[model samples]
Target: MIRVIVCDDQTLVRTGFVTILDAQPDIEVVGEAGDGLAVVELARRVRPDVVVMDIRMPGLDGIEATRRLAGPGVAEPVRTLVVTTFNLDEYVYEALRAGASGFLLKDATPQQLIAGVRTVAAGDALLAPAVTRRLIGRYGSRVRAADPPGAAGGGGANRSGLAPRELEVLRLIAAGQSNAEIAAALVLSGETVKTYVSRILAKLGLRDRVQAVVYAYRNGLADEMGEY
Candidate 1:
């Protein structure tokens, strides 16, 4: 079973998410929290496979919670899926940069919510939708906002580390191509594409697809508009 914890400041919204997820045979709502502090503590105790987080919580924000759970240098990173009220909310991008595996608008359908949890639990990112790519673009500049002066563009050593085919896969990933679509585009099997993606991410030291997209944009491997 995919154990999950639901974290939100709103009682009604939290309960609704718990209800929908618990109804799935393969998913269980192991814990629920009304704020970021409570969620972070609960997650430490539960070690859930996925944490469904809310952005606007009191006492602490979801972005920081995600950073604590999954950010770089974490001893044991928990997979986080952030749910927010607005697709264009800048905080959502911050949460992603903080190491969230994915984000969904709170109004997302129950099926989408369930899928988001499963996607994260299964170790696949939930940011493949083209619309999500646009959200990334809106803040793509922030990824490189602090770059050193004269930093060369276009992935430099990052591109050099990848084999030609792996480099192609990385570009496609930044372009928002799902594994299945990439497989078709390259006339390869889905498993093969998945393998290539894994290799590319490992080579680039990206935590997930969201970071991969950000890294691509930061290094000019992909354009801000998600075009390769």
Candidate 2:
């Protein structure tokens, strides 16, 4: 079973999520918190496989909570999935940067929410299609501008130590290509593509493909203006 913790300030919203997630046989709602401050202790105690976090709470807030739970300095970071009612670009970007594996709109369907939790619990990133496009579009230019010269052209030593093929996989990931699509494009098997993706994430020290996408954009490996 995939252990999970749900955190949200609103009682109705928290209960609704718990209700849907608890019904999944493969998932269990082990703990719940109504404030960000309480969540930190709950997470440490429960050590859940995934955390369904709300962006806004009375204290601490989800972003900071995510940072504490999954940030770079964390020794045993937990995977986090941020759920918010607002689709603000800064919130999405900051959540990811804070080490959240993914984000979903609170209005997402029950199936989507379930799928998202499972995805993150299975160690993959989950971003809504529209959220992905909008995030890339709004933040692409900033990422491109932040890159140093010769970084995108592969002229510099691959910072993440990825090989040529692995770099290609990372780019396709940023382009929002699925494993099957990447496999077809590269004339490789699905398992092979999955392996490549795993290696890429491992080498880059990223939590999942969503962080890989962020890494690609920030490092200029992906075209800022390109449609994903």
RMSD of each: 3.4, 3.8
lDDT of 1 by residue, 43-144 (tens): 999899999999987889899999998887789999999998654558877887888998888779999999999999999898847566577667766665
Error of 1 at 125 (Å): 1.0
- For each candidate, give its TM-score against the true structure: 0.89, 0.86
Position 137, candidate 2: lDDT: 44
lDDT per residue (tens digit) for residues 1-228 in model 2: 999999999999999999999999999999999998899999999899999999878879899999999987789999999997555677777778788998999889999999999999988888765567567546754744343222233423445488978888888887777898889888899999999998877766566887777777777777633333
- Please, what is the whole-model Cα lDDT of each candidate in the order they appear? 0.81, 0.81
* Weakest lDDT window of 10 consecutive positions for candidate 1: 145-154
TM-score of structure candidate 2: 0.86
Backbone clash tally for model 1? 0
Error of 2 at 4 (Å): 1.3
